[model samples]
Target: RWRIGYAPESWDACLNWARARKIPEALLETAGLVVRTDDGRVYDRFRDRLMFSICDEQGRVVAFSGRILTADKEQAKYVNSPETPIFQKGKLLFALDKARRAIIEAKFAVVCEGQVDTIACHEAGLEHVVAPQGTALTEHHARILKRYADEVVLMFDADTAGQNAAMRSAEPLLAAGLVIRVATLPGEHDPDSFLKANGVEPLQEIITAAPGFFTFYLERLTKLHDARTDRGKLQIAQQIVEWIAKVPHAVLRASQLQQTAMKLGVPESALQQELRQYRQRDRTVATPAETTAPAEDPGHPAETLLLQLMLTDERVVPLVQQQLAADWLSTGTAAELMRKVLRLHAAAAWNGHTSLLGADASDEAHRLVTRLLEEKRPAPERIPAAAGDCLAALKRAALERQFQAIKLRLAQPGLSGNEVTALQQQILDLRRNLDHIPRLSVWRSAKP
Candidate 1:
């Protein structure tokens, strides 16, 4: 339906571009068919690497995504089309043109990370395959894939970076209402190499064994931190609590929390308490403070002010968002949960009151939400009178929780000087914040 032209004039010129360096002829031909470089710079574009031809629906070349092979550590491994008339990286799906019909027929697509991997999937009889062009999966990519199928089988590399990428990708995909199953190749092998050696049966088995994103994420975390030692177990508990706090689904999150507790050989009630304390500390410190005083709660009045603003005035959401992104909030379970909630809301995934209750929410979370919604608002006339009482209650709760965590940590045999100093500072700050409350006048009078 459209006219296409070439500037190199002949296939030989294209072949020369590939042959000038370590690039292979097939890759160069693929590049030539996609683009014509009159300036003879096509070779420079793919100069010393393995080339991946990005094709359109008809299998016609549209762009070239090449990977660097030589020992030069300075160069990036992935390179792609330079925005010509035929190629727009964002608009194109890596191998969808070849696999679209199959994807539509099969009702699923095996999404990988590279060109060769797509070819390997097809060769293995799993014809519905596609990948991104030298980029991570984006919203646009998810929408395009969702058009053909209800589910996407994500097969990424089995590495730390890949796992992290998959987790991030899940957010956007899940937000878009896509069903995603995450799969990883064994060891360091990618789909292409893995399929070539182990045969299709082995690759299929790996796909069958793929775990849900949450399960995989937890497994990855367990592998990263030691859970056998007391300190290790404490750290893991803290980390898992944070993770659970961020999950937007209450039911899903609670289930995950129970499972995580069982795996760590701890009581669910204990884990729930730990997470609750963590969140309370987080919300307490997020409020504006007069000084950086070892991270104590700002008091009930401040917390009420925050909750009131958060629920009643939408404008405060952005302020919370800014503080969270800036990392000014304390690094605790509650802070993590708040950050996740705000992030999901920002991304437009948060729908209603239910969505506000994250994974760590239990009867305690329900109580907090109920209190925020049902608490009697102080009259404008009585605002000053009521503020002190509320602030005092919040401060006490924060101080008690912080002292408990510190006591537990200190009870361990080998407390570092930094840790000891941190605990002392927190206690002092809690006392200081509490002293500012007028209702704590007796305590203030007792102090020097």
Candidate 2:
């Protein structure tokens, strides 16, 4: 709400008033109220326009958005106040001062894509409406909404570009820990046009029917990728899991995992396992000095492949668990992850890794799960053999570790004669067991 007399719109008028009132030049310059021309003449920055006062949440006017009064090819359509001491475009949301209470009472906020859209929604009786000032929705906007609203519905234009914009806004909003929904109008209509054509009732209906953030993401990505083929389905699953990782709530993510599995026609267990990995990748930060690919851990292939087999066939889990001891799983990051998976499975909290919806998994565990999800699934016929081979490999590694420990113990001078003999015999037995174990070529046979 810009008041007409708050500031003079003409250069001469402002100059005359300032001189008559003895206003300081430095104060006027610092306020960004006037522009100095090429010839050293000062002029009013805003003139003959419909000015909209932009205020902070405390209801103090800090800047303005001014629309052109008359069409001019050389003139831009709109002009905004330059950044000043009190104004930063990214930090302000238009109409927040007026909409705060309404948003809190309603328990939701309506975020339109532009200032006109915000104005239209407000006049149409939707009071809890706000808009970003000529920029994409930022984390600041999301933070502002999070303060007064449980959810924020995006009511951008119903066009391809508008849909894209809404989608883009979703990540920051979710990252800010706010529940997001999308209100898509029919055809090419925007909030303003829809309200004009169908009035507030229909417009409200559209908002009421808006999909939740994850649901909107699934629908949007589904259209972009064909899920009829296995590869398409896998790709869609990866995208959905990645998006779900953006959701900060593990409970919410677990529920979305089921929905994603059903939507992509993949196993819920596989998705659950993959969700862990996706979350890990989302949390990963790379160093600026590193340019080459990250070094691959030698144990990852076997460990992940074993998890993949167990993910596809739950019956192998018990047998795999029996062969892997707590000390054996302490060998590598992958081994440690498998230990958690085995422990969860034993407690009935994990159903092929997908059922542990409530278990808070670490980022490293998630990264491992995601890698497994992307790998080729073992053929149904080969699962048994692959599981057996992986089991043997795990066992042999465990024995070899034990044998090394025994030899290290034998190196100490404090060891008794009987203790040294016992250690040597145990080492011999471990070596014999290692020789009898099968070579697990499970990776070669598990190709898609």
Candidate 3:
């Protein structure tokens, strides 16, 4: 049994919104819920957007998650009902309400990242598709998902942010002992666009051929840093090894390490040694010093960079905003602080003493934030002169960090011949690059 409610205006409004967005009416009717306003006025919930009616276990519309189509001066892009007697974001499994039985019977759930994608999957005959409500899959969502199926196939978007979200979601799912398979669509297409373009068979093929998450991550890293060059390859390899070290499953980790070694033309023994040395060195260096203040948390580098940029060149705030909002920054505490700073800046309430993340912020974070607010602003005329120096310092710090990390890995025992060769080549290449930087001065001096 399902309860339904709707304002007359909301019903027509929602129908039009769905039709305009190309959502089939069958989905709407099948969802079984309706939009309602307490006073019979047009409700804000589905205003000027595409409405995705969330169904219940009995295939009745339990709620709606709307996607805004146009930018309203005062409106959120997506909106949903408040926790009604029947609906709660944490409890409701978005599209899964309609697909639970199929999922249970089939023993797998195809989880996507958005309402539209889930609907698209359902339309394409993937009856066990589900998604979160304009958010990352939370633990509650994972638990609910687990109840219906033990296997989850993540069909998230094929973008960097999407991939990151999928990866983050994986940790919790894996912890719950669910078998997870990651499926990436081609050419930046998500399930919706991919299905529309090539039908569901291509998507099915990609799912069938889907690689393990680590494999996907390594491949993505290689693409990010062109592995054709020695420096690029070294960077890629280090990044891959760091990621692989985080895997808790020994068998899976070993298998992934072997595959990674093969891909990078290094030996498995060398990779293992590098990871061990890196971990040992990290532990050794991370300890506090006696009679001296502890070193800044290694995580604070980005915060320091943000503070330096904000204090020295306020003109670069926009660039800083863009950088801070990048997907890489999303995982770090420093990045969150930067976002708060930006928000405060936007609201014009950013006083010099206003704390970010409250008074309990780490000493390093507090200092970085305070400096950002109180430090003297650099003049536009001085910015160019300062930019070069600042950039050089930043690059030097980055390289030093990389060098130390590599050295630590290199110090470990049990490197294979190929691993040793790869490492030697990387070290030599880095030295060569460093050496070439000085030669630029010789060319400049000769020209004069």
> What is the model-wide C-alpha lDDT for candidate 3?
0.62
Candidates sorted by lDDT, descending order? 2, 3, 1
Error of 3 at 113 (Å): 1.9
Q: How do the residues 1-448 of candidate 3 rate in per-residue lDDT, one tens digit apiece? A: 1122333334366677777999866555433333345674332344445656676544566677666666675777667754443444654567654676667666778788877777778778788888876667766566556545667888888888888888878766665556678898877998999999999888878877777776777788888887677777678778777766665567777887898878777778988987897777666777555435555445434344545555445565545533221222322555556555554554344553344647677886776666665655445665543433433344344445546767887889998888787666556545644553322221111111
Q: List the residue pairs that clash in candidate 3.
A: 31-61, 33-61, 270-416
Global lDDT of each candidate: 0.61, 0.74, 0.62
Which stretches in model 1 have alpha-carbon errors above 4 Å? Answer: 1-51, 56-62, 67-77, 83-91, 104-107, 229-234, 237-251, 267-448
Model 1, 162: alpha-carbon shift in Å?
A: 3.4
TM-score of 1: 0.48
Give the winner by lDDT: 2 or 3: 2
Residue 111 lDDT in candidate 1: 80
Q: TM-score for all predictions?
A: 0.48, 0.59, 0.49
**Using lDDT as the measure, which candidate wins?**
2
lDDT of 2 by residue, 326-353 (tens): 3333335666556556645544556665
- Number of backbone clashes in candidate 1: 7
Go through the candidates in order and give the clash count of each.
Answer: 7, 4, 3
| Candidate topping TM-score | 2
TM-score of 2: 0.59
